[model samples]
Target chain A: MSERLLTVSSSPHARGKQTTKSIMTDVIIALLPATAVGFYVFGLKAVILVVTGIATCVLTELCCEKIMHRDVTIGDMSAALTGLLLALNVPVNCPWWVLMIGCVFAIVMVKQIFGGLGCNFANPALAARVLLVASWPSHMTGKAFIPVDAVVSATPLAIIKEGGDAIPSALQMFLGFDGVYGCIGEISAAALILGFIYLLYKKVISWRIPVTYVATVAVLSFCFGLSAYEVLIQVLAGGLMLGAIFMATDYVTSPATAKAQFIYAFGCGLMTVLIRQKGGYPEGVSFSILFMNFVTPLLDKYLRITKYGEVKK
Target chain B: MEIKKGTFKKGIHPSYNKHYTSSLPIEIMPSPKEVAIPMSMHTGAPATPVVEVGQYVHLGELIGQAAGYISANIHASVSGTVKAIEPRLMGNGSKVSCVVIENDFQDAPCENVEKYDPETVSPEDIVKIIQNAGIVGEGGATFPTSVKLSPGPDAKIDYVIINGAECEPYLTSDHALMREQAAKVAGGLHLAMKVFGLDKGYIGIEDNKPDAIEAFKALNDDSIIVYELETKYPQGSEKHLISAIAGREVPSGGLPAQAGCIVINAGTAAAIYDAVTEGKPLYERVVTVTGSGIKQPKVLLFRIGTNVNEIIEYCGGLTDDIAKVILGGPMMGPAVYDPNVPAGKGTSGILCLNRADAHIEDPSNCIRCAKCTEVCPMGLMPMYLGAFSQKRNFEKCDEYNALDCIECGCCAFTCPARRPLVAEIRVAKRGVQALRKKRG
Candidate 1:
């Protein structure tokens, strides 16, 4: 007689080694290099903001899961990532209340409210950033983005808005040594680029959106009469790198088709330029990405990769 | 005429497990003791078995009868004695009535097995011959070839596109066949052209298969356009290939014939060649038995009804702890619980993956990464379909174009979040299909 040694599911019988925990774990690991760089660039303040954001996000998520009577998904670290991203988007000196509110928006409103992680129709952190920007424009503006040993001033977009003559040096802007003060994530171009490179190396993100987004912005900005250097500075400065690499490239919130993604990124660029040149906001990466995120699904519907062997009249 | 190069789309390059068996040549397995011929191996109506139990059958003799316009006849692969008539697992895991025969080793005489002159045959004769030959698309879709060949007069088929674009990973059966049987494939194309009365025929092969391209080029039939396709997942898809090579955009929700074109798989073409030329019926097909977990990956010329387990055993058995026993290529194949499934006309690849290799994480919430959208070949929103299906909202599934999904696994493969997209979307498809049936 065959002994019943162990109860096991039969073939397919097996799940791939890639689980939610593993994917979330990989994402956290990929985000670490950038987190460390942010900490280094902004000192202990950056760490505090990140810790606060993570705490609130995790707390909000746990609370929501409990109320929803769903299994606690804190183990997935998705909440942690959302918190980290939200924290990264704000000013390093942002009050704990601001971080908490952003965390609530990202975790409770953007992510969990829509059914968590992949189900959330938009990138939680990006949405939260946009929400925070819209709700508290003064706080979200370039008020505290000063670099270590640099004079605090306006961002290039802000400077252009006030007067193009008042803009910071191209080198300073490129190196994130701008005289302006801004959000927690916007001050360090080098740090964000480094983070972007790390994420690329980790394969956490593909280069398509970031490459196309920055290229489109620079090309369009140049074609629209902005000096080539200003275009480069604009591309390198502010939240363009942050939004392009971290926020705009959010897999779920972006357009699905390649052509659609290209258009989405281009749309983001166009919106950013319009807001900078004519609209009220000096920098529009946050709004542009969030707006584009809303249209991603529709874009995907209209633009799709043809099914193999799928022919039509 | 136009050779498309590499592509940049939302596609995944999963381990090209093709590296394992792609270099291997096609080998004929010794004839099996018994063969099971299923009538419903193709996409449409199940064929009706003509022979009774205990009846003797010769190689190439029709054992099953086509029931409708979409069905194809099933022929005996070997001279055998009908052992049993019962339900058996055909490729795609569907249980259908199959005629089981025990090989008699006599190789009994078959009827009308001869090569035909494509140039001399009239289009009507070609159609009748194709119908009699029981040839169907053998590219795993198993669509009846004659019905596709019989283009309506209003929808004049101007071009015959031979799909050599075996875009699925790890399945090199088409590649191996194209490399080895170029003449047979081309002859099948000629037969297709004659039947359709179409002038131009293009063989679309992916640029990745250099050897296969060279082989077709050497065949040098001026009428056959050996166009190299860009290396992309689903480039072999009928619409994408037509758009890529023929420069004709299939109108949304339209058929290829509506665009004055007819597409046939390279394997299907070879079967057509055999059918008209040798008067042989489609009883056996080439299958690529491959995966990282298998000990030896190879393209075997397997007879229908040969058990998958027997083939696996012949292939040196499992290399790792088996995770999945899929009946076809991973992208579109259905997972099977039992390895006793008999190979059929549509059984292109049998992927045996081990635990570490085949594992996918429990699906989490959709991040709305749109990876599903980016990689979706049908351009349908898989996320909405999956989300709505999870809620059992079949109506919303319809609204999301769940019917448009080809179930190509690209959404699941490229998803950063390990979502069971294809599995969920399939539920939605079934739901919609059921509702449509209810309404009808």
Candidate 2:
């Protein structure tokens, strides 16, 4: 006679039709469109940044797990996503050292130190970007964004922050025509939008965080100084799309409840506007996501999803 | 056109993957030469064996009698000789006393014990007939139907909720039963409603099953209203269904009857109809034999105590790379190593998954995304419960409502980092539940 077994132990069953590998594979495919755009805009530098970021992120994860006596999880491909996201957040002109620091911070400090993957309270890439931004403001803000033709220019946010009247045109920003001089990663709006499209098509990221966060930032930024159309440009330009589609929507760090996610996205947009309008920083997607990440657990606690059969309060 | 209103706040839509065999009608599985009927199929007290070794018994003969009001009887699935009454393996890695019957193939007949005349039977008599027939909830929760149908001294049920939702993917036994045995289900519903003196019945089906909804709607009786629920995991859960149709909240730590409702599965209703109309006990049920790894997928009308391996072989055998052999639907079913355990009353589906489908990586720490909380039908914090479970803090796990988790698998399904949220939480739930019973 054979033995009976515990069936409902938890997910995932060893024999489920879907697996973590399949999901991660789907995510990688989704991220490819955006990475290709980065290559088109920044050429070889974008490829170097992505490769270096991935290597550093993976190595750091392995080292941390080794030190903690935990099994190596390089197979999960989460560290690779973190690396890719970190690279996307950094400037195209960011030095190798800056990218390495961001990778270490993202993989070890933000992810592994706080309990890897699902345990971390905030998105690793966003936290690392925020930290890198704070530690080396000059490198982060002073670097020139170079386009395909080697044309260098300041980002629209930088132009606005510097009190320059000649801000880049909405069409130029939409097409990523000029921001190439400010930072490497922020160069092409077209490339980032491609990534957004890929994610939307693959359903790797839902529309809630990106749509809500952008709308919130657009309305609030317009309320400050930029024209409504200019605010729209700001919403679409810079790291707003990158942060919304990838970082802010990090399943682990984001609020799980729909009500809470709506609030979390709004908070992300509000903070982005707050930082852009009044804070020392010229752009704010990274800091905005990090700040909102801190409140995600609390938001989840109070903003419980109304369950089936639960009496509404 | 207006969008259909959903009952719950948040849910994940997993790949249906039902096309493998959704259109197939249920086939009847041949009764095994010998049957092993487990005594503890239901949740409450396990029945005690009333028959001894070497005794002859006919099909539907009572083998195990209910030990309590919350328990149900066990019957012989085939006309056979009682070989032995001993501990046998159950689907969930547990062991229970099971009566082994060796079939004679002659199908030796026994004298008619007793039959409840449905036309002359009173409400109480119907309840007695149900109790005697050994009917239990067939929607994976094998709670005794008689007790659920019995309203308390002050309790009055205004609604008989027929659970046709079958929210768990890949399990279509209920769906098949609804489509094929609508008359029988309706008859059982009548019996249940008559007993409760309820005037109205609501059949909750996930919007995914438009055909099942249409089938019931075509039978349009004023008493039965078919409500199309949004296609969401755990939509068929009792509390979720109660909220969906009746707009009633079964208070935390309370039963559904507290809010004037008693939930019953569509399969259970059909079984009840069989018992009252045909004087048959609950010895057989429609079990969905499916999964991507199986050679052929089928919904087989299988008798209780038939070996699972035999049933799978009947369905064209497990494919070469079978990894998991689950006893129910993928969402909440348990994995079983043994293929010898017989299908019990609650066994509705047997899912055979291939190696590619079965590989699960180790879970990472909680990312605190709170997705688990959003999708939880019970409104419990799965992340915290999982954390507490990891910490072995059973008390905290209980406080977080770990027991309330129906193990719907929604949290795990939506977790991007692929954290084993429900797996860890279930451990804590079991730990806490054991402690509670110990304290009591």
**What local distance difference test score does each model get?**
0.76, 0.78
Each candidate's interface RMSD? 5.7, 4.8
Consecutive 10-residue window with the lowest summed lDDT within model 2 chain B: B1-10
Residues A153-217 of candidate 2: C-alpha lDDT, one tens digit per residue: 56677767776446666676666644333444454556666767776776555678878998898
Docking class of 2: acceptable
Report the lDDT tens digits of candidate 1 across residue range A1-313. 0121211222222222344566566666656665666676677888888899999999999999999998889988888888988888887656778778988988877777777767686788888888887777666665555545655465566676776446667666655533544566665676677777776775666778888889888988888898887787788766888788888888778876678889999888888888776788778888889899889878977875655334445
Q: Largest TM-score belongs to which candidate?
A: 2
**Alpha carbon lDDT of residue B376, candidate 2?**
66
TM-score values for chain B across all models: 0.95, 0.95
> Which number leads on DockQ?
2
TM-score of 1: 0.83
| Model 1, residue A103: C-alpha shift (Å) | 3.5
